[model samples]
Target: MRIAVIGGGISGLVAAYRLRQRLGADADIVVLEQGGRVGGVLHTRELAGEPVDLGAEAFVGRRPEVIELMSELGLDDQLVRPAGKRPLIWAQGSAHPLPGRTLMGIPSDAESLRGLVDDATFDQVATEPQRPLHWEPGADIDVQTLVGDRFGSQVVERSVDPLLGGVYAGISASIGICAALPTLATALDNGASSLTEAVRTAMPAPSSAPVFGGLRDGYGALIAALTAASGARFVTTMAATRVARAPGGWVVDPIGAVDAVVIATPAPVTARLLHHVAPVAARAAAGIELSSSALVAMALPRETPLPDNSGILIATGEPLRAKAFTLSSRKWPHLAEREVALVRASFGRLGDDKPLFWTDEDLIAAAVADLSTVTGIPIAPIEVVVQRWPGGLPQYAPGHVERIAALESAIADLDGIAVAGAYLHGVGVPACVASGTAAARRVATACIENTQR
Candidate 1:
């Protein structure tokens, strides 16, 4: 039973691993990775003689997928949580405490955003419940449009944009509420009279468990474990050029005939592969857009005197080049033990990807200058690493939910092949893991039925 898993990202790797567990020793699972290595955007590297994640640093621990997978892989010992510190919002040329108990930066009450916004905006948010709201049930629109109309531009720009940018690598103006903030959307659908009420109703109940988790060594550990456990033949630097219907099953180009295929690539690449087999699905995927981003990880002196906060998020309209700063040493307890302080400066977004083209030296300089401006500290880096992620994140634009639904429906009847990636339900590591597991189940089930026949 030969199977092919294309892409080699978290989604693809998880699919291959799941397939191995389901199909056992007899199945031949091949992972085709176009890059020199696996882990697509989940790459980790050494910095100052210690492993640090160059791509995604953490996963939402509240989500069961990552934690459960860690336990299954005997990697629970490597799990580490954050220090429960909150990030600050850099706006209006000052740093303000990020509004608490808010739903993705949308304030549940005016008090949360009191000092963050100006007097006028604060007053508007305070009286927001008094203002009548008209929301169409089952409607979808950008977060900025919905929040801006009710809470004013400051709430969307200063409060919401930064948080959304951190998640989507895009601004609130491009992110849809239905997918980005499902709980709030359901609240609005259930007849919430105001945006404030929706946010309040949608806020997650307080829990003692940490919100995020990460591997002690880095994501590279997780990737290495998944690759080994999958027991799949790794085909590095090989891109699956085509996937077409073959007698009894399918033929994956260069990989030959296989009982099944998991196309877990980026949206554009997935669209291209599905074009011949699932044209409608291809069009839907092709319509989905991607956002680029860059990161500058700097290791400064251990006594750099950085703020006590977790990180600083930049608001829209801010003059700063960096979108956010993750104080690695402050945020993660495990990293605090390092001899030097670690900070990661994020750059680029959906509309602005100029930083991706900037040289590593330029990116490092911007990160240094911005860190100095935000922290009021003299900038000096003992070591630096710059990583560029072009087309890294898929924008969950307005109508995204509907588009994905249609795409999935169009491919429902395609036998022995399935699609999965960040472009699906979410862009987070947990979401990708879920998508891959589901894809493997679908493919494995189909392969079994064929064998029975």
Candidate 2:
């Protein structure tokens, strides 16, 4: 059997690796990467002789899939934790620690939230009458509406919006409350009813495990290892312009043919690839939106006094050039040898373009100004690099789940074809791997069914 995996991003790589694991040496596996190198979003850059991650910085801990994969690749020991895992919120002209008792900005601890807001606001939040309503436990709902109803518009706009911008690079209004955060939605459905109560109930159990971890060398190591194991022919600078079905399976024109295919590229690219194979699916994919973002990574002199926490996320309305800056030196000590500071200034999101978007020089100036306000440290970056990702972050708009389900249904009817990436599932490294793994399993099952037939 022949299998061709499209897009050598993490998803494509995982799918190919799983095929090798499940189908053994009998099946021929090929990975077609449009880029010159693998590790789509897992890029690592060097600054002042120290490795800096420009793409995904860390994966969530306790996520068994990422941890298991790390162990499999013998990259577990390289895992390092941030100095203080808690991220500070930059709001109200200052950087404030994320209030305790909150689960992703939802009040898990009402008392903790009191300190975050004024006394009057706190009273209103705490005494806010729970409107008479009934939502089933674990029932899906819109997150933005849920937050505004349970908490207040203030909480959502001031905290939630900026936080989402920091991590998802999107507007909270766009992200499906249930799909992006299922547990909280379930809690809201339960008698916990209100946002504060639901947050307290849904708060993650305490664990000794670290909250975040990154490779000693970098995430690039995992990408390289996965690429090597896939044993697929890599083609860089060759963007897959189209995809179509061929006899017995599928044929990737100008590339080759295979019994199966897995697309692991971004939403736009994936949509373009599916246009010829399945117009409906392509259209559905094209409609799924994404946000633009830029990460300005700078290496500051060790003498700089960075923020206390791992990083700080500015509030939605806060006047700043960038959204937040994660102190890499504080987060992962090993990454910086000297007193140098490794800072990542994230800028831009949907409906907000204050990143001073233009040349890297302009972007850098804006990021520096934002950093000055948040960190109170005025220092020039010795080495700075700007990575602009246009429409990189997928927006899980309202009714996203339904659209995705419809798209999946359409794709299921097609033989020897599969779509897997962050766009369909959670937009993180773990989710991508899970999606790829599932696709690989599906392919293996198809191969078995073909043999029986």
Candidate 3:
């Protein structure tokens, strides 16, 4: 059986690797990457004589898939936890420490949010339990609406927006509550008396393990390891333009016939590839919205007085142009040991194309200005690196899960075909890994059954 995995991102790599494991020497698995290299957004670069992640920096340690995958690859000892985890919110012309005991900015204790929100807002939040929530079970709703209705607009803007914005590059008013924050979604769906109480009840006990984990070297190592272990033929700079139904299986354009195919590219790319064979899935994939972002990484001199915390998240409506800032040197212990300080500032998001229109120099200037404004530090950086990701984040709008389900149903009858990526499940590394592995298994099983028959 032969399987073709399109788009050599982490998902595609994982799919190809899992396919080789499942089918052993019998399967002809190949990975086609249009780019010059693999790893997709999981990119790492050298700065200040040390490795710094220009793309995804870390993965949630609580997710088992990533940990299990690392263990399988003999990378268990290479995992490095953050030295500091407290992140501050920059708002109202100052930086405020994010409250502890909160779930996605939803504070479990109203008193903990005293400095974050106004007294009136706190009073409203305290009285929220008395008011009955009215939400249909399993129904989708915008995150801003649900949180704002219960906790007031101040909480949504001051607290929730910054956190969600950092993750989705989207406004909470448009992002689906359930799709973005499933834990809070469940509580809301169950008609919880108070969001605070619900969050407190649902909060997991604190663990010594850091919430996030990263490789000692970089995620690039993981990608390279997967590529080496997969033992699949890799075709670089080859884009799959189309896929058509052949007599026995599918024919990927320019790649000849394959017994099975996994479309693991971005939603729009996947849509175009499937347009000729699966129109319903194509339409659904095309409908998914995406947001673009840019990161300005700077290597400052060691004398720069960086913040003690992990990073700072900029609340919406703030005067600063940058959305957030990560003190890479402080957040990651390995980076701190270097002679220079590494910092990353994020720019642009959904509905904000101003940064996208700016030249690289202008973007860097803006990021530096914002960093100085937020941190009250005006030191010049020894080096600057700018990375732009067009359509970097997929926005999970209301009814997104249902739309994905419908898309899946539309293609269920089609043989030897499966789709997977951040668009189908959670956007984190672990979730994408799981999606890729699952897609590989589905296509592998189908191809094996056909061969047996």
Candidate 4:
């Protein structure tokens, strides 16, 4: 049986790899990637004689899938914990350390947010527990609306917006609380009187292990390892334009017939391919919005004294153009062994227009200026690497989870066909891995059933 996996990003690669493991030598598998290379947003580049991630830098260590994948790839020993984790929030023309006990900027204790919010806002938050929770169970609401209603707009702007922006690259006012922060959402659904208490109760206990994990080499290593192990034929620079139902199973346009198929590309591309076969699912996929952003990596002199924190997140209304910054050398001690300091600055988000419109040089200049302003240091980098991701992050609007479920149901009727990627579930690396693996399992099950019949 021939199986086709479209889109060669980590999700697609994982789907293809898992499929090979399940079917073994009996199946004919082909991976179709439109780009010349794999890895998608997991690109890594060499700078100052060290491998630095230009795309996603790390994955949440608490998620077992990524760690398990690393171990399977024999990258267990290469897993390195971050040297620093705490990041500051740049606001009110000053840098304030983020509170320790908070989930996605939602404080578990009002006193923990003393310096971060104004006195009026603090008073409002202090009284939130006594205000009597009023929320519809299982109903989706924008993050800002919920958090703002309970704690006022100040907390949402100074605290929640920055943290959510770092992840979704979208505005908190539009992002669904349930989709973005499920723990908090569950607590709200359960009628938790205080969001702070709810988040605190839901948060896991602090562990000795680092919150995030990255490969000593780079995430690119994972892509390479998966490709080598998948044992699937790769067809790079070949985009699958369509997926139509065939007599026995399915046909991937320009890629010939396949008994099974996994559409692992972005939602828009997935929608286009599945349009004729599953119009309802295609419509749901197309409705999901995407956000764009750019990252500027700079190599500064080793002697430069960067901030002690891991990095600084720019709160909304700050005088800086960049939304976030990562002190790569400081966060990962291994990078500091080199003769240069590595730093990455991120620009743009859902409602922002500059990053999409700015030239590479403009982005670099803007990043440098913002970094200097925040750190109070005169910045001059020896080298700069700019990476732009257009529509990189999918916006999880209200009812996103439900919409995905409906899409899944719509496509479930088709035999040996499944969709997977960051768009289907959570957007993190681990979530994508799970989504891809699950899709592979579904296709494998269908293939087995077809043969039996």
Candidate 5:
């Protein structure tokens, strides 16, 4: 049996590696990547003698896909975790720590509201139990409204919205709550339920669960390891322009024929590739919406004054020059040998949709200005690196899961072809890895069954 996997991003690489392991010399597996390098959105660079995470950073430790996959690949010794610190939300010209014992910014326990909320706002939220009517099914909960109703406007606008903005790059109102945060949504469905109960049930005891860790050098190392271990044929910068059906298999045009194919690129790119193989599927893939985002990393001299902790987030309501900043030096001691600080600024989102067309120079300038405001330093950036992503991240809107369900059904009738990526399942790194592994298994099993027959 022969198989073709399009795109060399993390998802595609994982799928190809698994295929090589399962089929070995009996099957022909090849990977094609349009770009000069792999890793997709995962990009890291060393500038001014410091490591900067230009793309995806930490993976959720709760998810086992990344950890298990790393262990299998013999990367267990490279895992390490930095000291943890509290995250602050900057709003109204001041930085405020988020309230604790809260689920998605909703205070479940009254004590959690301590100094974060005003008396009037607290009294208003206390009236949630007095409402005359109960919520009905399919009643869309505007995230802003839900946060304000349960806690206060301060919490919603200052903390919740800004944090969600960083992830979705879109407003929280239109984003699907269940899709973005299923655990919090499930808890809400169980009744505004107490925060204590939610905490006890929603997350496993901290002592029982393993802590989160990242590659010792960086995430880029993980990608390099996968590429080296995959013992399959790999061709870079060879874009698959067309795909057609041939006798006993499908022919990925501009290339040759293959028993099966896995299209693991982004939605827009994937849609274009599927245009000929399944026109209907192409149309559906094109309908999924995505936003653009840019990351500007600046390395300041050791003389630069910065906070002693993790970093600061310019909340939605803050009058800032940029969205957020992460103090890399404080968070990760190994980032630099000297006392120099690495500050990262995130730009672009709905109502702030300007970064999509920003020039590299402009982005760097904006980032420095925001840094000056947050740290009270007027120093210039010693080194700057700007990374822009066209369709930043996927925003799963209402009934989005259903739309994906229909898309899967449309492709079910097609032979020897399957799709997987962040677009199909969850958008995190671990989820993408899981999707790739699953696709490899499905195709491998089908190939074995056909050979037996």
Candidate 6:
């Protein structure tokens, strides 16, 4: 059998690898990547003579997909955990401990945000449960509107934005309530008396397991392992123009006919490819917008006096060009042993693309200035690496869940075409891995059916 996997990001690579396992050695699996490299946003490089991730630094360890894959690849020794240091939030020109016992910064109780917000805002949050809440059962809305209206704008900006920004490269305003905080939505739907009560009900039970994990050698190791195991022919620096049904299966333009096709590109690219085969999905996919961001990973002298926190997140409207900083040495034990201290500054957001246009020198300067502002320490980096990810993350706008459902349903009727991408579900690495595996399963099953027929 012949198969085509479009896009070479984590999703596509995972799909290719899974296909090889399911379809056996005789099957020809080809990965078509528009970029020259396969990892896509999961790039890693050497800094200060050691590996550092330029794209995604870590994966949610609670999700077993990533860790399971690592074990399967004999990369168990590369697994590493964080130092369990809590991150700080820079708000109102000062650093404050990130509020605990909160669901992504939406405090379960007002007491958690004591010193972070003003008196009036604090009072409002404290009495929030007394106020009657009106929520539609299946309603979908942006996080800012719901949060700002209920908990006050301070809560939305100071608490919600900082946490959401790290995950989506966007503030609460750009993210949807249901998709980003499904548990909270469920609580509301179950007739919680107020937002405060809903937040309390939705809060996950505390666990002792580490929240995140990373590879000792960076994500490059994962990418290399997946590529080697897939044994697929790679067509890089080329795009799949279109996909349509052929005589026995499907044809991915520029790659010829294949037994099955997994459209693993971004939302926009997926929309384009499915235009003719699945118009309903195409429109829904096209509606999903993307956000851009840039990163400045710097190597400073190990003696630099940075904070002991894992990272610092700047509250929305903060007078700073960077949104967050990951103090790598403080967060990861493995990274701390390096010759130089490592820090990563993130720039831009969903609605802001100005940082992507800035030169490397400009980004580095901003990182230095911002770091100095937040940490109250001198900033001097011996080496710097800049990476820009334009349209890297997709915005989970209001009704995102519905849109994805419609897109998936529309494509399900197709004989040998499947879809997998970050835009379809959660944007994290584990979700992408799950998506790729599911797509490969669907395509492999279809190919087997065709052969039987």
The superposed Cα distance between candidate 6 and the true structure at residue 401, in angstroms, equals 0.8
lDDT of 4 by residue, 1-453 (tens): 899999899888999999989998878989999988888888988876677898888899888999999899888887888886688999899999887678888877789898988999999988887877777789898888888888988888888899888888887886897788887778777877677667876777888777898888998889899999898899998899889999999989898889999999999999999899999999999989888899999999999989977889988888789999999888887777889999999998987756868888899899989999999999999988888888888899999989898899999888899998887789899999999999999999999989898
Q: Is candidate 2 or candidate 6 better by lDDT?
A: 6
Q: Report the Cα lDDT for residue 141, model 3.
A: 86
Residue-wise C-alpha lDDT for candidate 5, range 271-379, written one tens digit per residue: 8988887887787788778877888888888767777766787766666767778777776656634556777788877556687578899888888877777767795
Estimate the lDDT of model 3: 0.86
lDDT of 1: 0.94
Among all windows of 10 consecutive residues in model 1, the one with the lowest summed lDDT is 107-116
Residue lDDT tens for model 6, 1-453: 999999999999999999999999999999999999999899999898889999999999999999999999999999999999999999999999999989889888888899999999999999988888989999989999998998899999899999999999988888888898999999999999999889889987789999999999999999999999999999999999989888888889897989899999999999999999899999999999999999999999999988999999999999999999999999999999999999999999988999999999999999999999999999999999999999999999999999999999998888888899999889999999999999999999999888988
Which scores higher on lDDT, 3 or 4? 4
Question: How much is 403 displaced in model 3, in angstroms?
Answer: 1.1
**lDDT by candidate, in order shown:** 0.94, 0.77, 0.86, 0.88, 0.73, 0.94
Residue pairs with clashing backbones, model 3 = none
TM-score of 6: 0.99
Q: Model 5, residue 125: what's the lDDT? A: 52
After superposition, which runs of candidate 2 have C-alpha atoms over 4 Å from their true positions?
Answer: 133-141, 336-339, 353-356, 451-453
Q: What is the TM-score of each candidate against the true structure?
A: 0.99, 0.93, 0.96, 0.97, 0.90, 0.99
User: Using lDDT as the measure, what is the rank order of every candidate, best first?
Assistant: 6, 1, 4, 3, 2, 5
Query: For model 5, what is the alpha-carbon lDDT of residue 299?
Result: 80
RMSD each, Å: 0.8, 2.3, 1.5, 1.3, 2.8, 0.7
lDDT score of model 4? 0.88
Give the Cα-based TM-score of candidate 2 against the true structure: 0.93
- lDDT score at residue 91, model 6, on the 0-100 scale: 93
Question: For residues 347-406, what per-residue lDDT tens digits would candidate 3 score against the true structure?
Answer: 888899578778989988998899898889895989888888888888999989888988
- Which is better, 1 or 2, measured by lDDT? 1
Q: Which stretches of candidate 1 lie over 4 Å from their true place?
A: none
The number of clashing residue pairs in each candidate reads 0, 5, 0, 0, 1, 0
